[model samples]
Target: MKAVSLVPSLTEAVAVTLPGVLAGATDWCTHPADLDVTRIGGTKNPKLDRILALAPDLVIANEEENRAADLDALRAAGCEVLVTEVRSVPQAFAELARVLAACGAPGRPRWLAQAEAAWAALPEPPARRTAVVPVWRRPWMVLGRDTFAGDVLARLGIDHVHAGHLERYPRVPLDELRAAAPDLVVLPDEPYRFTAEDGPEAFPALPCALVSGRHLTWYGPSLAEAPRVLGEALRAARR
Candidate 1:
C-alpha cells in the first residue's frame, strides 16, 4: 500500500506503524528524522505534480493542515485522498486508527494504544488555570474555539482564554492579548519558534510557558508523552 502523508503527525504514525509504506511526504513531515520519502512540499502548498508522479495508492491529509483545493485536485486526478478531521483528543485517536487501517495496517498499532492509556491515566488537576496560547506572532494569531491544541491543553488543566472566540484561530492584536488577563501565557515552538528570550519578554507580567509544538499540537505518538512533557513546562513556568 503506497501512501503519501501530508500531515507530519500522520506521517510519523504511518512510518512508525507500517514502515516503507510512504512513497512521498510534505517537506514538513520531520519526525522519524531518517524518513527517506520523496519530498512533495509544504502542507498548505503541496507539489501536486510531484505527488501524482509517485502514484500513491492513498494520500493522507488532515482537514486543518491541508488545502481543500489541493485535495480536490488530487481526487480529480484519480488519486485516493483520505482527509482526516481531528478537533479533539478523542477525535485524534479515532482518526489515527482509521487512517492507519486505510493504510493497510493489520491491526491498531501499540503506540496508539499506549497513547490512549497515557492520556487516560492523567489524574484530574487540582485546579484549572486560564491561558492564552499563541501559535503565531507577527500578526499574533491564537488558538481559539474548537482547536485540537486547545483541547489538549484543556485536558492538562489549562483552558484557553480564547476558547469561546468565534473563530478557530483569531488574529488578535498584541495589545488585546495582553489585556485578556490570562493567568499564564503558553507559547509553542512551532508555527512560530517562541523561545525563552523571544516570547517571555512580551508577557513580562505573566508567567510564560514555552511548550513543544509537536507535543501540544501533533496528534500521534507525541500524544503519549504530551501530558508529562507539557505538564513539566507549565509547572516550571508557574514556579
Candidate 2:
C-alpha cells in the first residue's frame, strides 16, 4: 500500500496509525524524512514532481499546507488526493478518520476508542496559565489564536495569553512578553532549538522552559503521548 502524507503532523500520525489501520506492517514513505521539508512549512521547495514521481496510490494533504495549484496538478496527474485542514486536535481526529477511510483500512473504531480513552486519561493541569513559544528567536514568535498549538494548549486547560489578542503565529515583541507576565514561557525546540542556557538574558526575570517541539506542536496520534508528557512537565514546574 502506497501512501503519501504531505503535512508532517499527519505524516507522523499515519506512521503510528497505519499499524492499527492495516493491522500489520505497511511500507509508508513520506516526502521529508523529517518535518524540515522546505515546502511543508520551511523555506521554499519548487518540486512537486518529486511527490508525483512517488507514484502513490493516495496522497493526503492539508488545505493549510498544500497549495491549490499543487493539489490541482496532482489531480491532473491521476493521483487520488485526500485533503485535511486541521486547526485543532478534534479536527485532527476527524482527519485521521478520513485518511483511514480513504485507505480502505479497518480498525478505525478501535483506534478512535483508544484515542478517546487516552484523551480522557489525561490528568487535570495545575490551575496556572501557560504560554508556549512555538518558534525560537531570530524573529521570536508564539502560537496565537486559531492554531493547532493553541488548541493543544487549550486541551490541557492551560490558557495561552495571546489566544484572543493576536493572529496565528504573531511576532511578539519582547516588551509585550514582559507585559503578559505568563506563568511559563515555553520555548519549543524546532524551527530552531532554544536550550535552557540559551534563555534570552533580556527576559531573565521570566519563568521559561525549553521543551520538545514534537510533543507540543504535533497534532495527531502523537497526541496520545502528549498530555502525559506535558502534564509531567507542568507538574514539575509547579514545584
Candidate 3:
C-alpha cells in the first residue's frame, strides 16, 4: 500500500517495518538513513498539494504532530487517513499496530516486539529527582503535563517540575525556571539544539543532562534504546 507519513517518528517506524509502503514523508522524517521518499514539507506545514499529488492509499498522521485542517483537507480529497494519538509508551505501540494493520502491512515487526520487551524489562529507577526539561529556547517552552516525554522521564525516575501545570507545554521565563530550583535541567537536541556549550551554561548552579530528542521524546524503535541511552546521560550530569 502506498502511504504518506507526516510524523517523523511514525514515518521512520513505517519505513523500517514495512519499507516501500511509504510514498512520501515530511522533510523532518530523517531516519532509515537511505530513505528516498518524496518530501512533503514540514510536519506543521506539509505541502498539501504535493501530498495529494501522491494519491497514497493511506496517510499516517499524529493528533499532535499534524494540523487538523491538513488532515481534513486530505480526507476531503478522498484519501484514507489514519490519525494516531500516542501519549505514552503503551499508547504508541497500540497506535502503531492499529495504523500498520489499517495500512495492511504484512508480518509482525521484530523491532516492535523488541521495543515492548525493552520497556517491559526496565527495572524501576532507584530514586526520583526533580527536573525541568526545555524543548525550545527563544520562547522557553517546556514539557508539562500529559506529555509522552514526561511519562518517559517519570519511568526513568525524573519528575517534571511543571507536570501539574495546566499547559501541556508552557513557556516559562528563565528567572522563574531558576527560581523553581530543579535538582537538574534536562536538555534535548531538537525543537532547539541544546549542546554542552549552549544549554548547560544557562543553569550554572544546577546539573544538566543533555539527551537525544528522539530518545527522550519519540515513541518508536528508539524506545528500545532510550532507557539505556537516557539513563547514561542523566547519570553523567554533574552538580
The CA lDDT of each predicted structure is 0.94, 0.64, 0.89
At residue 32, candidate 3 shows an lDDT of 80
Judging by lDDT against the true structure, name the best candidate: 1
Per-candidate alpha-carbon RMSD to the true structure = 0.8, 4.8, 1.0
User: Candidate 1 regions off by >4 Å?
Assistant: none
Q: Candidate 1's residue-wise lDDT over 140-216, tens digit each? A: 99999999999999998999999999999999998899999898999999989999888888888999999999999
TM-scores of all candidate predictions against the true structure = 0.99, 0.80, 0.97
Q: Count backbone overlaps in model 3.
A: 0
Candidate with better TM-score, 2 vs 3: 3
User: What RMSD value applies to candidate 3?
Assistant: 1.0
Please, what are the lDDT tens digits per residue for candidate 3 over residues 1-82?
8999999888888888887999999898889889999999999999999999999999999999999999999999999898
Number of the candidate with higher TM-score, 1 or 3: 1
**Candidate 2 residue pairs that clash:** none
Full-model lDDT, candidate 1: 0.94
Model 3 scores a C-alpha lDDT of 0.89
